[model samples]
Target: MTKRTALVSGAGIAGVTLAYWLTRGGWQTTLVERAGDLRSSGNPVDVRGPALSVAERMGILPELRAVATHAKAIRVLDSTGRSVARIPMSSRNGDIEVLRGDLARVLWSAGRDDAELLLDDTITDLRQDPDGADVTFERAAPRRFDLVVGADGLHSTVRRIVFGPEREFSEYLGLYVATVQLGGAPAEPDEVVLLNVPGRLLALHPARGEAGAAFIFRHPEIPGLERGDAGRQKQVITASYQGIGWRVPELLDRLEAADDLYFDAVSRISLDSWSRGRVVLLGDAASCVSLLGDGSTLAMAGADRLAAALAETPADLGAALRRYESGHRRLTGPKHRHIHRAAGLLVPASRFGLAARNNIARYVLGR
Candidate 1:
């Protein structure tokens, strides 16, 4: 019998893990990524719950633990740079916190040999029929696959082509987040130092022998802000954080010179359906819960579930896709509903709210 063929877009956590599991399930999987190589820069992400089991099943859990950040505490500071609260980090059932890049690299190393990897290429158009989907790429010739999965990201090209425009599915959460690598190590190597004002937050997270700075602030959606225009993004960030204190001026100066900065609105994706014909969406492309959501964890677990569903009914692609969507929604739906609560906790909207959060941290959580 001929094996099933699958095409997965995006080489992030979801894409790579799906490719690995699909190959092991006796499918021919082609993983396509726009980048020339795996991306090595992103904020720290968690790999816990079902994702941990997924990693163990793939035999990469040990490497993930080896590269874990192991942050000891969260040190909160006021605008004056005075430490207001210190919340100790506690592991929940052996959960590990690793840099997003490190987790991606580890997953890629484990899965790279299992599937055909197409680098520096992306899907330009997708046309699906009852039997298979015909895909056109930027650099590669058109090909047909029994299944096509869009695990791209929040602003997924595949999602745009297959579903519709991004704005229709995306819900802007009144906040934006940016992260950049700093030039020096953190003052406290084992702690995450965060400075919070009313509607903004600046954090220095120490990881992998260095520190990365994160800026998150509440703002209305900026009109005409394109993803490729870093200069404009920097300008907006500078404007939002202007006159802010506690190492922000220095950080903004660094941002002006930093070329590896990652910036995007902290938004969530909500879709009525995750599949259209033979094309299916996974991870952030389908339902993104943004920062507070265990996006990485859900991505890994969702991919595992998707691959298993496909294997269960290889001859019935529609049933498999439906099963994947139904099962995965159970994992992501609650996070989507409760995202506002988490956002308020992370970035309070008013000075009163900020003070309340700090007091809760110092008293309730700090203990």
Candidate 2:
């Protein structure tokens, strides 16, 4: 019997994990990433629950632990930078919080030798028939694969081509988030200091040796905010955070100087089905719970489940896809439903709600 071939788009958490598991399951895996290499910058992410098991199985748990952020607490601050409340970062279930780039690097190192990697390339078109899908790449030669997986995140090319345009499935949560690296160490290196005013929040998270600033604010979608236009995005951030107290002005200055800025809307993706014919979606492309939810954990767990389902029924691709979607939906559905609650806690819409959240964090959660 010929070994099945799989092509996975996006070399992030979901794509790498799926590639690792698929190769381990006797499938020939090809991983394609648009960037030249694994990205070295992103916000921190968590590895907990089922994802921990996946990491342990892959033997990358020790590396993840070594690079863990180990943030002592989340210190909430007033507009003037005075400490208002502190929520300890304690996890009873052995959750590990690591920088997103660190986790991706570790996963990539673990899977790079197992599969063929196509860097600096992307699929431009895909035509799927009963047996396989013909793929056209921007730089690589055309090829056919037994299956295609879109782990390409919120703005997935595969999902756009296979399912529909992103606007058809995306649900914007009335918020935008941007992260930029700071030049110096945080004042409170052991804690993630957060300052919020009504619908806006600025957080400084310390990791490794440096710190990164996060800007999250509630705003109606800015018309004509192209994803590739960093200058316009910075202008929007500047206008939104203009005259705000605290270290926002300094952070904006850093944002202006910083070459790497990650910005996007806090949006969710809703789809009636995760798979169509020989093509399937994973991670944020399938069901995005936004930054407020445990997206990294879900992505890893979903990838493992998907690889297992494919291995279980190699001959019946449809059944395997159904099994993967059915089982993984159990994990992602609740996250999608409760995202608003998480958003409310993270970025409150009103002063009253913000005050209540702080009180809850101080009096209830802080303890």
Candidate 3:
């Protein structure tokens, strides 16, 4: 019997996690990434729920837990730097949060031992047939695989090749965020300081005594802000938040000089289906929850399900793809809705709106 082969696009969290699982199930897997190596500078993200169980099954549970950031505080604040509330961190609560770069490194380190990873390459065209997919590459030679999976991110190249344009499914969440590593520390220790003004919020996530700040601001659909013009994007963000209270002016000054910037709208990807023929979508490529929700957790969960389904159906690749989509959609659909709903509840359009949210948070949740 010929060994089954699979191709996974993008080497980020989803692609690497799926590759690791497929190799364990006796499938020969190859991964292609646009980046020369793992881009390990992403911000900290969370991995929770059944996803943790999936990691434990791979025997990397203890390793991930050991490197957990141990984030002990989430502080909500006003424009004057007054504290609103602070949420505590504990393993007993069941959420494991770590830096996105760190978690991707962990997954890749484990998966690379079992899979063939082609760095600095990407799939340019995908033509699927009955038995296999003929994949065209940008640099390397074309290859065929029994199955292809898009574990890439929101701007997934694989998704465009297999599916149509992104605008058809992406729903803008009415906000934009900019994140980058900085040389500053938070005003307080272990504090997740979030300063909220009208239609905008800037947060500082305390990490190992230093801090990484994230800026989220509301807008009315500004186009062409993402044309690889980091300076222009910074200008637009700065102009939008001009004269706003809080430490935003200082934050903007710091952001302007920052070399590494990740900026995008807070949008979610919703698709009627995540699988077609032998081509399937996983993680942010399939379902993205932007900056407001537990998208990282969902991505890990989706990757686990996709890999498990493929492994369970070692012989029937098509059935495996279908099962993966159904299983994952079931797990993420509710949480997706909850997050979008909570977005409006969290990001206020006015001072009264912000106050209402705080009152609810203080009285209802009593945080």
Candidate 4:
């Protein structure tokens, strides 16, 4: 019997894991990523619930546990650098918290032996037919696959070409976020220090003597900010966070000096359905509640479920796709609904909201 074939766009968590499972199920998988190389820097993410089960089955759980973020607690502070609350994280942070890059690397290392990975390439166009989809790449030659999965994340090119324009499906959750590496470390390697003011949050998370700093704030979309221009985005961040106290001045100085910065709007992706014919969506491309939604774990679990469906119905591609969508939707919807509330908790839009949150924190996380 001839093996089936799949092309997974985006080499992030979802894409890599999907490729891993597909190959394990005796399918030929081709993974494409637009970036020149794997992304090696990102904030820590959790692996919990069904995602933990999937990791255990894949035999990568031990590796994940080894690299888990060792941050002891999430320390909250006022604008004046005074500690207001210290929240213990071990109980509710799920099975483990691993840096995003480390998780991706683990997925890649486990799956690379079984699949072909094409870096520095993207799917420029995709044409679906009764049999399969004809794919055209920006730099590579065209090819046909039995199925295509868009695990490309928030602004997925596959989703745009297959489903429709991104704006139609994505709704801004009233905030923006940026993360940059700091030149000088501010906190211990095992601590997450956060300072919150009305509508803004500045956090410094140190790992292995290096710190990754983040700026999240409530703001309307800037006209030219969506283009990923680091200069314009930095200016907006500096302007928005101006005069804010508690080590912000030092962070802003580092932000200006940093050359590589990751910036994007904290938004949600909602679609009526996640598949169209042989083309389907996974991870953030299908339903994203941003980072707060525990997207990394969901992506890993989605890949596991999709691969299971395909393995069960290897001969029936359409039926397998439908099965994957049906099972995955139940897991994503309820989690997505809580994003607005999560936004309020992380970056309150009003002074009243901030004060109310602080009081509750003090009551629960009393020092």
Which lDDT tens digits does candidate 3 get at residues 162-281?
Answer: 888988878787888888777756566566677788888787876555568787888877765655599888887888778877777888888898998988877788888888888988
User: After best superposition, candidate 4 residue 173: deviation in angstroms?
Assistant: 1.2
Off by over 4 Å in 3: 364-367
What are the per-residue Cα lDDT tens digits for candidate 1 across 67-130?
Answer: 9994889999998999998999898998999999999999989878889999999999999888
Look at candidate 2 and give me any clashing residue pairs: none
lDDT of 4 by residue, 138-250 (tens): 99999999999999998999999999999899888778888887855546677788889999998888754568888999888874476767888999999999999767887
Count the clashes in each prediction: 0, 0, 0, 0
TM-score of each: 0.97, 0.98, 0.94, 0.96
Tell me the deviation in Å of residue 14 in model 1: 0.5
Against the reference, the lDDT scores of all candidates come to 0.90, 0.90, 0.79, 0.87
C-alpha RMSD values across all candidates:
1.2, 1.2, 1.8, 1.5
Task: Please report how far candidate 2 places residue 272 from its true position, in Å.
Answer: 0.3
Q: Distance (Å) between predicted and true CA of 82, model 1? A: 1.1
